[model samples]
Target: MENMPMPKTRKPNAQWDANATKIFNEICVEQVLANNKPQGCLNNKGYANLISQFNERTGRNYTRVQMKNRWDALKADFTTWKTLLLSASGLGIDPKTGTIAASDDWWEEKINVMPLCKKFRFAPLDNDEDVEIMFSGASYTNTNAVAPGAREGSAGNGNGNGNGNCNDKDNGSDDVQEVYPSPAEKQPVKRGAAYKSPKKGKKNFRDM
Candidate 1:
């Protein structure tokens, strides 16, 4: 029997450390909220500028799609936090006394208390559901196989030629060409391999 394919994992970008989160938080607060706007609200130009600034400062590559997804996740977290705060106020407490206030000060205090980096960090995905959440529209394919739209015989070895095969006509060498595996290839585990739990850690994706 064939073994089931193992899930692929990626590491978090170190450049998108605490500093990047701080910058993002400040941008939203100063540029968007200071003018009496909602949290996590940004126009196209605003988002573009934010991405540019983040990449420029951190020297990291972040696509626009990633920034948008990250913003959505942050906004969702903010909304959930507010909802929980509102719900807590009604439990065994006087409404007028305000046991748990959800005010601007409260919001700012929450933001100040924790860095956005920690708040938005993603735990490593261990199941299909987690992968779906992290990569909603992405399709996983075997990197060892040619891509769907790739021209036949066009997958080349980084040598600039479309032909992966070494030919005496192309280069005056009758030696057999050495083929290398694509970096994205995943080696299959043997059947009945023991399952091991992944160590507790965070992973970064375009969304995070």
Candidate 2:
């Protein structure tokens, strides 16, 4: 009988590559946002920056163009994630068959894997108008919480979307609802209403 060749051992899969890439993409996007770094709208330079950071930390080599390509891939992955979330929200997320179905456990798993954190945090359940209604003054809760949609005007006045304002405006000018009530005593009164009853005013109308 011919001698049989020994089977070669396969190299173990590299888990770090996937995890490192995910971390790299997330940090780059966050850093760009935090520093208010400008890379032009629709620019993927942020993705390159992330790869650079990752290489520096891990001592791995990656070309800029390659990083850009990876970034593009990441963007595509993000779109998939968005779709999955949408589908999961509508149909429940089923982990067993990898199908969306109704179950908190599956849904939570899907949410936890989201690269950008919970979508709810970035996009509230309510509309802009609803946010305004929830975060409005007097009814606002967490007095310590930053006001929504309150921005410091060019003149340094807390005109729109400033910290003092109850309306918590996001960095991108999107408004987030407050959903809390102020102290009952400080609540505003209706227009043309008097502190006391109009009993005394009744006599004034008759005299007129």
Q: How many clashes (backbone N, Cα, C below 3 Å) per candidate?
A: 0, 23
lDDT of 1 by residue, 114-189 (tens): 4432231121111323332222222222232222332212322321212211121211222223233353542322
- List, residue by residue over 74-142, the lDDT tens digit for candidate 2: 443344443454544335322232233334455466567763323332222222222222212212122
Q: Which sections of candidate 1 miss by over 4 Å? A: 1-16, 33-40, 90-208
TM-scores of all predicted structures: 0.34, 0.34
Ten residues in sequence with the least summed lDDT for candidate 1: 163-172
Which pairs of residues collide in candidate 1? none
lDDT of 1: 0.36
